[model samples]
Target chain A: MLKLMQNEWMKLWHKKGTWIMVGILVILTAGMMGLMKWISLQNMGGEMTREGMIQDPSSLGGTVLLLTVIVAAGIVASEFSQGTIKMLLTRPVKRWKILVSKFLTVNLFGMFLMLIGYVVYLLLAMLLFKSDAGESLSSWSVWSKSLYMLLLSFGNVFITSTFAFAIGSVFRSSSLAIGLSLFIYFTGSTISALLSQYEIAKYLFFTHMDLTQFETGMMLVPDLTMPFSLAVLAVYIVVFLLISFSTFIKRDVTA
Target chain B: MKPVVELKNLSKTIRSKKIIDNLNLSLYPGQITGFLGPNGAGKTTTIRMMVGLMKQTEGDIVIEGVSLRDNFEEGLSKVGVIVENPEMYKFMSGYKNLLHFARMHKGVTKERIDDVVRQVGMQNRIHEKVGTYSLGMRQRLGLAQALLHRPKFLILDEPTNGLDPAGIREFRQYLRKIAETEGVSVFVSSHMLSEIELMCDRIAIIQNGKLIDIREMSEARESFYYIEATPAEKAKQLLTDGGFTVEPFTDGLLVNAEQHQIPDLVESFIAEGLQVFAVQPHRKTLEDEFLEMTGGGQIAEAYAK
Candidate 1:
């Protein structure tokens, strides 16, 4: 099983897209940082502060979600598209093990994107901040709150990415996976807002995905608790995995 | 003969249509066995079942005495295959593709990787990305990856699909060496008969999900002579009277007579006042025999004068 996992990692790393996607995200972060520098130069502001620079890319929750979903969606879908999965399956291992390794590679890539995003945020903030930047962002209370919000956002990103991975596995089309994942990611907050009037909104997986609301005390619906929201996310995770493995294991790869 | 792989009444049905029906075959070690069939003849389907890519509705593939149905991992561990084309991570170097496959099975070391690279004659370009490889090079790399574990059985489905004539010959030589040196049982399927005739020791001909016949090659192949003589009709009659299997050919008669009996045959023809113009070995290629077998065309008569 470990060997199979190792093989999956080898395949993932060998793909130029894996590195390219992360590079694209870093470039995007840099682009955003550049815009910040331009805004600071305009001198139409109170001194541009370090907190504001750090908050720029760090607040890119939707962008991170889109990129991560692409990573997660391409994991299993491209194998089918490229026909490499046939070679993968013919090896001396079970199909389930192969699927597990694919899932592992995708999840790890999601973590990688998060880490890379975090690093890019730090670098851009350090490099682009003005010499006369306002007060340093050193308040421990603000730091703790900021840390909680960022972790919550990243956690939600992982959850939605898994959802995309499942859809990709079922359809075996990366385009469809990316399309629907992005569609859902873009519309989830609006949908949640509309559904907030209904009591059953607390039960929707998308409603609870943005766990940052737990820290902000901004529940989508009345009487929604952190544990309850966590439970809903957990159920979604189980359902996503079940769909991924069941469809992957049972479908015949005729192509 | 020790069997490297055995399929007993194996079957696969997709969408209520039977793709394979009760396929039973035994592939022995140290020889190349050709799987011959026309298009959509269940040749690839059977191979897929053996490799566990497609589940068999009914039957077992026993590789080294392990049942594919009962223990797929163990059964598959003894087998390796390149289905259709050798699809690899095109973005990666050829060396990396082989290395990734090596990690799946135990005991395949760096030495073995280098050995296979050398075996396939891809040492110079092993470091290049697979996307840059020619079709033949990719085929060779595919074969190398299959042989990395020293599997007892190797299955190739339409392996020579896009190779040139020279490339095909080179690939055949590689398979032969693997069968002889590694003692691997090679099950290669193809629609080309001349190819199987040259490479395989025995050929299992399948048509419409059933084994048509198992024909042996070389010493086991049928040998005869094409006897062309004046008064061809009478020559055929005389030969038939002499207890020989004679069929009319466009030029003369095709006589299934042994080489030693040729002198007597010619003498009898001379005695009958017929001029013996041509007497030569009439070797029936696999294509010729298959045409006769499938009733697609007439034999001996089909060949031009």
Candidate 2:
């Protein structure tokens, strides 16, 4: 199983599209950071304090989470579209191992992409918005929050990637997976907001995926706990992965 | 001889349509068995089941005496398969693809990978991305992947489906070599009759998910002969009258007879004032046997139409 995982890693590395998606994440994240920094500089007036003018690095987590979702969707969808899953499954390894390998690779890619995004965010914030009247460097508490947000961002990415993987396993079409993923990611908050009036809507996977908000110490519903949301997200991950693996093992690879 | 692979009443149905009926087949080791069938004749499905790629709706497949459904992973480990187009990561080089598969199998070393690359004659181009390879090279790469683990049994569906003449010949030679030297039980499904005739030691004819016939090529070819004459109908009648079953052809009549009876047959034709333009022995090509066993072109046309 470990060997199979290693093979999956090699396959992920060899795939050109995986790298292309990563490049896109870096470019988009860096581009957004650079643009935000420039905009903040332009708004700086005579009375503007260094603290007000400096771009908050914590906001970088939001952009990283968004990029992670997009990258995860692409990685899961492209394998099915390219028909590489056939080769992977025909090996001597177990079916579940194949799915687990793919899941691990996608999560690893998500983490790598997030790291790249954070680095780019730091670079852009430092180069474009550095202050002569330096504000105190971010406190340990702020860094801890940022780290927690990053971890939560990964969990969010894993949940979304697993969902996409399940859909892609069933549909085996990249376009459909991409369309569904985008719909869920972009329209999820609006749908959640509308459903907030109802009791059951809060329990949806989309509602709990926003781990960033939890890390920022904000809760739309003060009664809802962070541990409860995390637990629900964990359940979703396990169920999605189980379904994906089971379907892949049993489904015929006629394509 | 102990069979390397056996299917007992194996069947598959998709969406209430039975693709493979109660199919029974046994493939022995050290023999190249050609699975001959037309398109959509459940050849691919049967091969898929043998390799554990697809499950059977009814019955079971036993690989090396182990039930495929019961111990799928173990059964699969003993078998190497290439179903239809051997799809690989197009962006990855051939060497990388082999290496990746090699890692999945226990005891597969760098040397073994190199050996397979050399065996497939892909050593020179193995480092190039598979997308850049020609159809023949890709087929070779697929073959290399199948052979990477040195499986006791190898299952290939339409192994030469898209190859050119030269590629087909190369594949046939390689398969023959593997079957003879390594003693691997090779089950290859193909539509090309002549290729199978030359390549397989035994041939299994399948029609509409049924195992119609499984016979040694020599034994099957021995009972049939193609004889050319001016009037094929008369020649067929004469052979039939002489206690031999005959099938009329466009240019001649194919006679089912023994080698010793050929001279007498020609003499009888000459005595009857019917010119025997050609009296050569006719071997039943895979195509001829497939057509005969499947009830000719009408069944194929009905399916197609």
Candidate 3:
């Protein structure tokens, strides 16, 4: 199993698509951080509290992590499209082992990129402006919020990567998977808002994906707790991974 | 000799269409068997079934005395396969691809990897990315991967699909050497009959998902030969008188004589005032036998009962 994992790790690094996705993640994360820092500096004359800025960092990390999901989805989806699955399957390894290897490698890559983005965002935020004039930028609350954001970022990327893997397995086309993933990412909140008047629409995976906001005490809805959202997100992750595994195991490599 | 791989009453169906009929074949160890067929003759499907890639609707594939369906892992462990086009991570170097494959086998060593790379004559370029390698090089790398595990049985589907003449010769020589030196049973499917004739010890011709015939090359070559000579009528009489079966052709008398006996027949014809224009040998190639056994006609007709 360790050898199989090693092989999968080698394959992940060797795939050009993975590196391209990483490059895109770095660029887009840096670009978003720069843009937000510029906007904040331009509005520096107004009152800016340290507490507000600490609260705002979660949203920033959340949004950047969301974009990272899209990038990671493309990386995972291209393997199916390029017919590399055939080569992987023909190896004398179990189907489940192969799936787990890929899942682990992809999440590891996502976590690495998330760390890079977080560091860049924090550096830019600290360099650009001072918070609340007299308050120190280094505090336990600020540190706690940053750690929480990183954990949430990890969970967000993990959930999204698994969902994209499922999409890739079922659709077996990178274009379709990327298109549908982006469609869901960009339109899910709007659709959920429109359907909020209904009773059962709140149970959707998209509705529970922003569970981190609840963790940072930014809940817009009553009675939705951090634990409840995490549990729901965890269940969705398991379901999606199971679906992906089943589809991948049964799929014939016609390509 | 015990057969290395055996398929008994094998059949496959996809979407209510029978892709492979009740096909039976046995390939013995230490022999190179060629799977000869035209396009869509279920050759690829049969190879897939043997390698556990596709499930057979109703059949049993015994690899090294183990059932493919019942003991898939053990059965698959004894076999190596290169089905369809060679698939690899094109971004990685060829050496990396082989190393990745080598890790899948239980006892393969790093030295084995270097040995296979050298055996395939790709040692110098093994470090280059697969995308930069030519199609022939990719094919060689695929073969190297298949042979890396030192499997007792090798199953290849159209292994010479895109090879040039020299490349084909090199591939045939390599296959012969492996089968001889390593004592591995090689079952290769190909449309190139001449190559099969030069390489295979025994061949099975398939058409429209059915096994038509399995015979040794020597036996297949003994069917008949076309012989041409001047004074066809006299030549026919002389051949008949010499205890040989002769059929008159437009320009010659086709003889059912052994390859060595042709010289005697030719000399006899010359002594009897019959000038020999030509005594060309026209034995049926594997292609000709395949066409004849498959009821030479449209592919759909070949499938018809």
Among these predictions, the greatest TM-score belongs to 1
Predicted candidate 1 versus true structure: per-residue lDDT over A1-255, tens digit per residue: 777777777777777777787788888877877876787789766567667555433455655777889878888898899998888888788888988887877767776777788788777777777533344566565456556667788877888889889999999988898898887777877788898888777778888887777666777776788888888889889999998998898877778
lDDT at position A163, candidate 1: 87
Q: lDDT per residue, candidate 1, B140-259, as tens digits? A: 989899989989999999889999999999999988988998898999998777888889998898877888898667565566899888787788788878998988777778888888
TM-score-better candidate, 1 vs 2: 1
- Model 2 per-residue lDDT tens digits across residues B1-305: 99988889998999999999999888888899988877777888887777656778999988888887787678778888887788888878888888888887778899999998888887899999999998888889989999888898998888897899988888888888888898899998887778888898888888777888888876634566788886766777788889987767667777778888888989988888887777776655567657877777555588888
Q: State the iRMSD of every prediction, in order shown.
A: 1.1, 1.7, 1.9
Q: Which wins on DockQ, candidate 1 or candidate 3?
A: 1
Over all chains combined, what TM-score does candidate 3 have? Answer: 0.88
> What 10-residue stretch in candidate 3 chain A is worst by lDDT?
A55-64
**TM-score-based ranking:** 1, 2, 3
- Report the lDDT tens digits of candidate 3 across residue range A1-255: 778768767876776665776666567766765666677668764555544455445544454455555544654456656666656666566667777776776676667767766666666666654677565656677678667766765665566667776787677665666577667766766776667667655566666666565665644344566677777777888898888888777665566
Stretches off by above 4 angstroms in model 1 are A1-3, A31-58, A123-140, A217-219, B218-222, B230-232, B297-305
Error of 2 at B257 (Å): 5.5
Q: Is the docking of candidate 1 incorrect, acceptable, medium or high quality?
A: medium
Superposed Cα deviation of residue A27, candidate 3 (Å): 3.4
Candidate 2 local lDDT, A114-186, one digit each (tens) = 7777777656556665544654546465456556666766666667766776777666665666678668877
Name every residue pair that clashes in candidate 1: none
Chain A: TM-score in each model: 0.85, 0.82, 0.82
Instruction: List TM-scores of chain B, every candidate.
Output: 0.90, 0.86, 0.86
Clashes of each: 0, 2, 0
